[model samples]
Target: MNIRKTVARVAGVGAVATAALGLFSTGAANADTFIPLPGGEITQTLSDGTVVTIKLVGESANISGSMGATPVHRNAWVSASAQVQISGDTSATGGKIFPGYVVGCQVTIDGGNVNGGASGGVSWDNSGNATPSASANSGANLTLGPGQAKSFYVLDQEVPDDYGNESHKTRNKFTGNSGSVTWSDETIGLNGCAGYAQARSFVSVEVETDNVISWVTLWGQPFSLG
Candidate 1:
């Protein structure tokens, strides 16, 4: 149960004005919280040495908490934009996947597959339940081991745009291990706890598959940090 904490610079104001420049903490690139304000934005070079840009925007509406004297601090604006290149679980068994900040995602796999069938596939329930018989392709049953890797393009998967059951919003409650194809221009929403940025507030997730699951069961919102 590891939790990655997000820190605020609040830029001494003087440093930004005097030094003419300030840098955010260069830490793990896993699904982290990188909030830039007033004309601020975050750029990162991942473990693969690829550069990424993150945008943040404040809410237009002021939220009054409890309708009382204390006003809820405006949640800073944050948006992570990057090509979702995924891989690294083609071989490991009964493991987990994680958002290691900048290391991409560590996917988990198991020997489970379409119940009582040949060609052996991955399953979401290693407990010996059968997947929907209509499924066409198998889940992520591969890994890159401790060194190999792969990549994928990311775009938004909004429920409104979803033509099927694979939408991010629909999958949010599914307990089975799996991954999402984040569309370009998709809004991660706030708190990193749900919607698209769930991993943000999670710290880290633990992924495991022994009997039926093929993908992973995250451990922390940002596993490495968690």
Candidate 2:
């Protein structure tokens, strides 16, 4: 059997298998099967009764690999989106910074029988900033098994950026704007490395007001890579 084709086939099957096993079930009747990410909505209430909501609409991935020589290389392109809204009684006099939304993907690699592991992810934040920023992180010196398996992160709704930068501070005490924030077709890429790869998307929020710096993951899905 062609290792490349076989690996690719397994990657496709992995997405379906994950969904069939209820791993991708988000209690949404209209959940998508082709995308390897979570499909649904989430809502959270802040200390001041501010309601933060997020939703994952859809996601997709493209993955390929080459094993012609030693130290194979695999690359992937992942994309996803979400809808974010903040309403209810928001603070108007407190020094609170609301980071509205974040979109990105995570990858995990498991080399079958080789006892090897590597992981990484990339994401962008639309945290009330005019110009959003993107970032990525991964392990070093990765090695995979003969038939390793990888996972993709399709949608994670609640992720925080590295720091509570001024640009990411979407809402402040002065402008207690309560409305909708949407990120569409946001994309990130991963290159090099080998073994099986999987990816998914995520949405998140970082509240840096009242000494509360917390992040929450609202939605997520998984896909396969070569």
Candidate 3:
């Protein structure tokens, strides 16, 4: 249950200036399409009576067509804020929050497949037990073919381990009733895919109690990558 916390702050005026530069910087080669997304929220109560709430706010993506100057490549920059709140008795000290995204190539992530299997390695089961695959990578630069998808964490925090060695983690651990993580202009580079693609955000929190441990996940609306 060891995790690191990283916070980034951006002033309103600075953000506006950055956007202006990105829009008027170049003609078509650097023409980035800014998309404002409607983030989502969810709440779940664990079996041990611990209530966990997750929210994704200020979601957005700026897509630039074919950074490789070829049809088989795509690139985008994403931003979002994931907030978590935990409430229960004394046993519910706190939890760990893991936030990431799933990118799919010609694959639908909004719903289940025809066979009710996981869509692009993500499960949105109705039993309030949604979870992402453990195969997610830490790097957003990825390669995929048709009918393929991959997941990656937004955080790559570097810290020291118990033995004073360098270590990396993708989650933020909190010991109170609330915690949050936010990222801005994170890169999502895709290669080897010539068709339409999509990306979705997820926040999974691991709640630890004296008697039981559980997880609750909240999924954001999926958006196109191309």
**Top TM-score: which candidate number?**
3
Query: Which number leads on lDDT?
Result: 3
| Number of the candidate with higher lDDT, 1 or 2 | 2
Off by over 4 Å in 2: 1-38, 64-71, 92-193, 208-213
Clashing pairs in 3: none
RMSD of each: 19.0, 15.0, 7.9
Badly placed stretches (over 4 Å) of model 1 are 1-70, 82-199, 202-226
- For the record, the alpha-carbon RMSD of candidate 3 to the native fold, in angstroms, is 7.9
lDDT of each: 0.20, 0.32, 0.60
Error of 2 at 13 (Å): 28
lDDT of 2 by residue, 92-131 (tens): 2222222221111232322211112222232223321111
In each prediction, how many residue pairs overlap at the backbone (N, C-alpha, C within less than 3 A)? 42, 30, 0
Tens-place lDDT per residue, model 1, 1-226, is 2222121211000000000001111121223344322322333232332222222222111111111111111121222221111223322122221211111122221222212222212122433222212222211111122222221111112454345555331122213222221111122111111111111210011222222222221211221111
Task: Name the regions of candidate 3 deviating beyond 4 angstroms.
Answer: 1-30, 112-136
lDDT of 3 by residue, 57-88 (tens): 79888888654767677777777777777775
Candidates in descending TM-score order: 3, 2, 1
By lDDT, rank the candidates, best first. Answer: 3, 2, 1
TM, every model: 0.21, 0.42, 0.78
